[model samples]
Target: MINAFGALRPDQPIHVFTKASRWLLDRTITVPVTIVEQAVDSGAIQRDSLQLDVPATLASAAQFEAGADEAAVALAREFRARHVQVAVCDAPPMPCTAAHLAGVPAVVLANFTWDWIFEDFIAEHPAFAELPARLGVRYARADAAWRLPMHGGFGTVRTVLDFPWIARRSRRGRAELRRLIGAGDARPLVLISFGGYGVANMALAHHAGAPYRLVLSGGAEHSPTDAPPDALHLDRERLDALGLRYEDLVAAVDVVASKPGYGIVSECVANGAALLYTDRGRFREYPVMVDEMPQVLPCRHIANASLASDRWDEEVAGLLAQPRPEIRPLVNGADVAAGMISAML
Candidate 1:
């Protein structure tokens, strides 16, 4: 949403509705919603949190549904008060409900909607049987659903656009960031990131026996002795201090070790960084993203169990020995989506 709106013309005014979920904060490693709220508060964007209690986990569907309704009513009132005509969101159904209630056009921008994710659980747990249908009905109200690459295409919405990948461009040069991270010009830098929920045991990366510096994303607080003398934790604060964006770190690195997430995968592929990833348990997008590896860029699969063990050392060494090729996947997605939304106004 930040990137898209940044691409908008100067005349366009955009109001973003941010919300935080305590349920999500407890589960995620980074609590991204809080970061979004922080960004808004810091004047990075024109936005505010709805102050609603949104449930992030599927097990909390009952609470989520009730919360969504309350949030929808509050959000609709805000949209009307602001004279907003269009809305866009990635997951959860409340914003769609708000846009519909406020009689505004909504564009659902995501690799897969929440309903698509709920459908995967329905077969195993019957409690989610009605959820797919109910959520689908809410998402169907969108004017358009633009699906990003490496997505598990949605069954709920018929008009899904095969949207190009969206990634942040690198601001600082490679040498400068490497120097900031305290990595030597010769040694390779490997970044281990698993989104907001971090990997518990990264000490195993030390066993690779390669002369590489391992950088952990999200800053879980590590001792200098955690890995080798060279391993470091590159938290958001560290990146900010170096004037580097998250994507800048990803772009500057030799390899990115991450789970199969649309944002990370798309960024790695588009920016020409080697992707070494592991399975994300029960995530619907994992299968499609993993299957897309060989087709897009050089990638390797790291087992979940091996993440805590020293068994992945050989694979890590092999991946590090390979060359890094930059893959550019139409970086104009934000501009395109922004233009589409602008036309609606």
Candidate 2:
């Protein structure tokens, strides 16, 4: 969403409201962001820990609901003080409700809503039965929604407008990124990314004799304690010193091996890199992304067991061998969304 925000009219004043997390603060977003501590938690599923912690998720939801009124009051105060005309959110229920409460026109940009996502968890914990409906009410308060592709059914939001993929493209060239990462053109470079919270017990030494060079970002926190010779762990500081962004590494890679998430999938598409994906548990968005990704780029699926056991060479080979799609989707959704937001202003 920050990438789309960057594309908005240069003269338009935009303020981003988000939780203060290392994952968000580390990125270079050219916009004024207002960090609202403890506004909400989406209870994101950890790829390494596939087991859904129903109790924890439910508790997080309750906490979010408990602070909604207070958060809304603060947001309303800010909106009035700034003379904000329109509020934009990447499909957060609280922001929509808060914007409505503040009497600010809210535009939601997302492929799926939390109401649709939480619906998948009701069977695991019956307490989650009411969450979907409750969140649906908040989502309906939004003035409009800009739905992206590869999305679930958003039954709550009243006014919906379909939009293209809003993905960040690489700013640097492939050769430059490879040189920065110390990866030569002789071997294939594969990026191992599992989002902000990386997988648990990831043994990078398992890829000791692998055919490709492995790269990991955000330091040794995610790297194997005994990493193999071929593995290159790029810390945040190293990346910053080299002037390379995450998207640049994605563009330089031959393939991305991980669970299929919207951010990674869109980046791979924009950079022309193949994807070797594994199952991301039972999240509703997983199936939709897995189904839709193959149409735009070369993609292959590997079981979680195969991924964990270091048996990913076959899938990686398949992904690399697969030809690129003759017709690719437009990678300029951020600009398109910016144009719409400009008109709205």
The global C-alpha lDDT for each of the candidates, from Candidate 1 onward, is: 0.65, 0.76
Residue pairs of candidate 2 with colliding backbone atoms: none
Q: Write the per-residue lDDT of candidate 1 for residues 1-345, one digit (tens) a residue.
A: 444554455565656555554443333222122122311111111111101122234556644664666767777888798788787776556677788899998778877777776677677777657766877777877767887777764666657788777665666777777787777657677787665445543455343445666776665543222555556667767766876667777877878877767777777776667888876566566788877766676789877567656545566577866755455467667777878877777
lDDT at 161 for candidate 2?
88
Alpha-carbon error at 166 in model 1, in Å?
1.2
TM-scores of the models, in the given order? 0.82, 0.91
Off by over 4 Å in 1: 20-56, 200-205, 220-225, 311-313, 320-327
The local distance difference test score of model 2 is 0.76
How big is the positional error of residue 40 in model 2, measured in Å on the Cα after superposition? Answer: 3.9
**lDDT per residue, candidate 2, 241-291, as tens digits?**
888778888998999877887888889998989998877777789889977
Model 2 earns a TM-score of: 0.91
- Residue range with the least summed lDDT across 10 consecutive positions in model 2: 45-54
